[model samples]
Target: MGKAKYLSAVEQGMVVGARRTGLSVSRTATLLCFSCSTFYQELPHKLTEQDRQLLKCVLHKNHLSSVTTLTTEYQTASGSNVSTKTVRRELHEMGFHGRAATHKTKITMHCPNSLLEW
Candidate 1:
């Protein structure tokens, strides 16, 4: 069965506590609505503290930075290859939403202060 939700530390602890209390794996899994394999699975986080620091620094210096640019900078700073999608995902997780320029200027706008030509 698919995961009902991502298992946080609290959820893992609950599973462990349940197991210690003589609850069977299937019973615990049923109670939590998690698959039996979920208790045995451990997923590592993609970004490190250093990577987060670098991302914060880069974003602070340039608010308009694109995901591609962020990925490039992260790769350069951390010496690790990362995809733009990963960078975009991390940005979203950190609450940075995509920004698009919406303001448009007139095509033919004359200068307010113009000198008379002979």
Candidate 2:
């Protein structure tokens, strides 16, 4: 199978329309790089635009904060006791996740005596 893909509303509508026009489900899904199961499954409640904006602000203010802290901050900002998992998921969807630069040591090349002769 190909990599997972998230389709937009228009793309999903096209899929449904394509299926109605006698296109094979697998073929249509493969063309769009989408999974058939996800196409048919109903998604749960998604964060609204306002909620996402608030979350973004909170995240920016606490860039190094943990998921639990973010969740609490979001709740205080938006007056909703959202779950930590939900906050984490929204953060991931918004392209925010834990990542740190790897530490590296400087490298030095040893000079060859034979090559040093002028």
Q: Each candidate's lDDT (Cα)?
A: 0.78, 0.83
Instruction: Give candidate 2 regions above 4 Å deviation.
Output: 1-36, 39-41, 108-118
lDDT by residue for model 1 (24-54), tens: 9889999989887776564344788788778
Worst 10 residues of 2 by lDDT: 37-46
Best TM-score among the predictions, by candidate number: 2
Residue 55 lDDT, candidate 2, scale 0-100: 95
Clashes of each: 0, 0
TM-score, candidate number 1 = 0.49
Model 2 per-residue lDDT tens digits across residues 1-118? 7555667789878887888889887888788787777675534456898999999999999999998998988899899878998898888888998998999998999889988895
